[model samples]
Target: MSAVPILGVIEGFYGRPWTPAQRGRLFARMAAWGMNTFLYAPKDDRWHRQLWRDPYPEAEAEALRGLVEDACQHGLQFVYALAPGLDLDWADDGDRRALAEKFVHVQRLGVEHFSLLFDDIPYAVDRAAQAREQVSATHHVMDTLWPDGQAGLLLLCPTEYCGERAAPSVATSPYLKALGEGLRPGVEILWTGPQVVSTEISVQSVREVNEILRRPVMIWDNLHANDFTLHRVNLGPYAGRPLELRGLVAGLLSNPNNQLELNTPGLFSLTDYASGKSDWTPEASLDRALEVWLPAFNTSSIHRVSLDDLRLVSHLLYLPGGLGPQAVRVLDVARALVNPQTGAEEREALVRELRTVRHRVITVLRALEAGPNRDLLFDLHPYLVDVAEELQRLIVWASHRGEDDPEVFSYRGSLADRLMTLGWKT
Candidate 1:
């Protein structure tokens, strides 16, 4: 296997697409981070998915041409993807021609790589027949465009792309077996491990799919995806998958959070994993990424809050587990405040620490509000504002011997409401 696997970022989330400027910035970042591919498959793009046969307007075509040029200049392969399975008549020759023609139009814009997506659509009654038709149609398109195999990369996302959606089982499913055997060897298939939003991707699982497909798979990782629920955001470092995965697959493309600015740390840590860094750990990688990420706020006050502290808060938001050391310490303070046996000195100490955390959160939030990363602030503003407000209430209660004032009761009610929104325990 090569030392560095083909690392890429797929803008394949179910939300608003990034603007042209955001994409230009993303290409430059991908180049600097040593990523080699960018898959443009935003699910909300009307023409790319719903109206797959329609031609792009003059202005949209110009924008796409410019994006292709930018990607090429950055040494990135811009893979143009179209999801036509929603209403495509795969057996019709006219439908096949339309699919080929749409791709050819993109090819004229200098995009050499292409993908045909059949994911998220309902399965046909005759599964095997559906699979065969999908394979045949894709083969026809590929043969028509690149008879000599000059098309840089032709990728496919089968309808049953993950383990849970695979009927009966992965090894015994007739639809998968047909796809594995019928599709041309030149074409690659995309997989999302055992589940759509997989918490862990093991080598054994990859090997199972690889044996069935007789080829290495390209991972479309949705670990950091937040489209399923708007209230959640994943900011934790990339973990769970072992480093041995570098040799098991063709490439790893992360489907990141909708908020563009918050994805820097996650993508940076993924780059470290792909680069084969022996010393890489998720905690350390997150800290290092934050060093570069926090400075973007252009605020001097942000220097006072440590990256570890920020990670502690973000970890609670994204990952599933008990609180970390910082949260544990804060909880301990809260407990002591409510304990009748606690002394004044202990209460004061706890109050001081809580006040400090509150101040740090305020400083960071203020900087974020005033900074250029408006997207990041928009995603996290509510959470930050709530934390600051809760901290103030906690401070006042701790100072006043857990007084049952209206403000404290109101804070308790608001805390419960916030926790419900995030699906977290109050």
Candidate 2:
């Protein structure tokens, strides 16, 4: 009936350090936007460190109490993350007892939800079984330590791609299924289906896994966090920037999960979702794209480029790979569409020139086939061999000619040159 509740993870597992005041402000902002859950997963914060075990420093404990109190005041649940999965060094009984004490203390502060991270924790050297045991032991500790056997919901971040098989091979599937089944019964599983990036996963695929594990599965679909590196926003290079919000909304509505998160960077991705620009004009969309790109493109040096120039550039290069050579060509065409820089007759001639070049590139790509020439491509292809084959589909899309006498890549390797040549003020 109502929209799904999205959990905005503040002080994520990775990011710039946030002061208490900063965290309080972040929570308040999420609350203002109707967010209901906050997952605190800072790796080396003082509150969750090994030293926190000592007589439970009153001042530090009270500071945490204030965070929890602030969250409740804004109608949000504060999910404290214990480092057992990723921080197994802190999983020893002594450390566990200390953490248990801290958890109990936090309960008194009115915080109930907690998460156990097992995702990025390095595997043990000798036997793989030992790593699984280590994770189980930590869950066992939390199961017993929580007040009344269920102080709050326990969120498990298992080792195998959030409990999905890496390959369909029998050897791997059995191990993943076992890990999923082995998790505590009442605990909620944070499953990030196979890949952490934006992916097309069906509801049926999710239901099958949930049936096998016999537990409620929470989808942690990372539609934006591609490299596992946080802070890079996922707005499209040009016009598609606002369009990305549609993909995010589709993912949210695709599956009605009790929880959803904007896993991109900083604020929300897509200006429409972030700043709420909904006019949908060719000129307006270009301006939004430049607002995102100019800062990222001109990071190293001072550049005097107005937002209008950025808008003009972005409207032309709206391809998925962003403002690459292909996008630049597209921008040139879009500009030519309205008014030709040279002349009316010359504008038609420019389009023909671009089309001829695009035709040649397409022939070159189709010849590559597979196998030997695969290594010629860049991006996640060679690194993640499986996804490389899929990249071939992108070539055709990227090769499409733009309207303005298809802009040429004069300096093949220079990103700056490509931008400057395509009418972008340098």
Tens digits of per-residue lDDT for model 2, 1-426: 113334454353343345577567657656654556776655556555333454447886787788888888888788876554445444367766665666666667666887665666565543246435745655765765563576666666565544343335323455446656576676666665534543444455555556655654665544433234321223232122233333232112111111112111213222223334455543444344345434432322323334443343322222223443444764465456435245757655655644543443333233332323232222112222211221222222233433323344333467743553454221
Model 1 worst lDDT window (10 residues): 417-426
Write the residue-wise lDDT of candidate 1 on 346-422 in tens digits: 87888888888777777677777776677777867877787776676667666764455524254455664645434
Report the Cα lDDT for residue 302, model 2. 29
Spell out the clash pairs found in candidate 2. Answer: 286-311, 316-331, 333-403, 333-404, 350-405
Instruction: For each candidate in the order shown, give its overall lDDT on alpha carbons.
Output: 0.80, 0.46
Q: How many steric overlaps are in each model, in order?
A: 0, 5
lDDT score for candidate 1 against the true structure: 0.80
Cα lDDT for residue 288, model 1?
Answer: 69
